[model samples]
Target: MADLPNCPICTMPDPLLAADGYECATCGHEWLAAPDDGLDDIRDANGNLLADGDAVSIIKDLKTDGKAGGIKVGTKIKSIRLVPGDHEIEARVDGRQLLIRAAFVKKA
Candidate 1:
């Protein structure tokens, strides 16, 4: 069979394939070879790669269109969907679907 993909965490070559996905032998970290949606790599403020369903926190106060008081600093946002763009995070907060910049958030 073809070689398995490298581990995302430790960068170890060839994690073994399993029913769920691949698991790193060195770090024991398990991750899928690619996301189901086929979106490109998504990174956070600290440059940590983000995956779908990742929870992130707003690092600074961000003004939204309708909200009189904008989103507060340290607001926890869950289930973020990464899209393809400069400001490329899709999330729902306070009943509003918002497109947030990755620079303003860190993995929660």
Candidate 2:
């Protein structure tokens, strides 16, 4: 993060490599340098792909709406895709493909 100091609030070490940047590991601070964090490991703390993701998981107790609700942690998910939204995750669960929020799930 050029010109911008790592978040003072969160004293997390940011290892930027020119083109892209991301949040500090210690703190949930995201750094947006001029471009993307080529490292593209931008998963939630749980490691779930942030929508349009390419993996799946059930490592956390996730709450759902409509007919499906209460997905127990450790529920294995597959074919995850990342999306652009608050809960950024697109995967198939219980045979029903839907968009899941990243914060709610973890990597498998």
Candidate 3:
């Protein structure tokens, strides 16, 4: 048997292959498998590719809602974690966890 990919919606590993596409048994989700084209590459503001544990610096000052202060430009962040979703970078700032968009940071 051929190896099947995990469901994109639920992350289930046992999606069954169907005539049209793959179907997730756990979540009842169906999706067509596309070729892996490196579309998920996360790039910084300087167009540098970012990876987990890579250090980065904020390129722009960002405001925090209901917070006393905001992230300043050139603030350094170490050991960044890459996460899925709109905000791709996750790091700790000022003792608080923050989800930052990759566009606001640059490789440091």
Candidate 4:
């Protein structure tokens, strides 16, 4: 339905409206619309809903610019900005701006 929004957790386009809230078929996470803005919650890897300025940590070592020295596991990334794409996480690491996949990080 046009009125119903996409699931914030899995980004599923269609979610069923239950008595309590909207239930996502993809991830099965139920969410209620925010009373103020009507936007659903966006969850991080740890099932914690993420917001701007939230701190997250890398789950694994990630290569950058084809370098052998990559971002280490458990690297703490701060003040992350959540974009529209499922894996898009914009943040600055070591004074360099980069885009990190959401699946590789957890809320810190």
lDDT of 4 at 68: 56
TM-score of 1: 0.62
Q: Which pairs, if any, clash in model 3?
A: none
| Model 3 global lDDT (CA atoms, 0 to 1) | 0.90
Question: If scored against the real structure, what TM-score would every candidate get?
Answer: 0.62, 0.48, 0.64, 0.57
Model 3 stretches astray by more than 4 angstroms? 1-39
Alpha-carbon runs more than 4 Å astray in model 2: 1-41, 46-53
Q: Summarize candidate 4's per-residue lDDT along 1-108 as a digit string, tens digits.
A: 358878997887888888867898878889886455322576767788778898999998899995458899999998998766555688999878888877788999
Residue 30 in candidate 4 has what lDDT? 92
Tens digit per residue, CA lDDT, model 3, 1-84 = 888898998898999888878999999999887655443799999899999999999999999876877999989999999988
Candidate 4 deviant stretches above 4 angstroms: 1-41, 66-68
lDDT of 3 at 67: 87
Quantify all predictions' global Cα lDDT against the true fold.
0.87, 0.61, 0.90, 0.81
When summed lDDT is taken over every stretch of 10 residues in candidate 4, the lowest stretch is 33-42
The window of 10 residues in a row where model 2 has the poorest summed lDDT is 33-42
Q: Flag clash pairs in model 4.
A: none
Which of 1 and 3 is the better model by TM-score? 3
RMSD of each: 10.7, 12.7, 5.2, 11.8
Answer with 3 or 4, whichever has the higher lDDT.
3
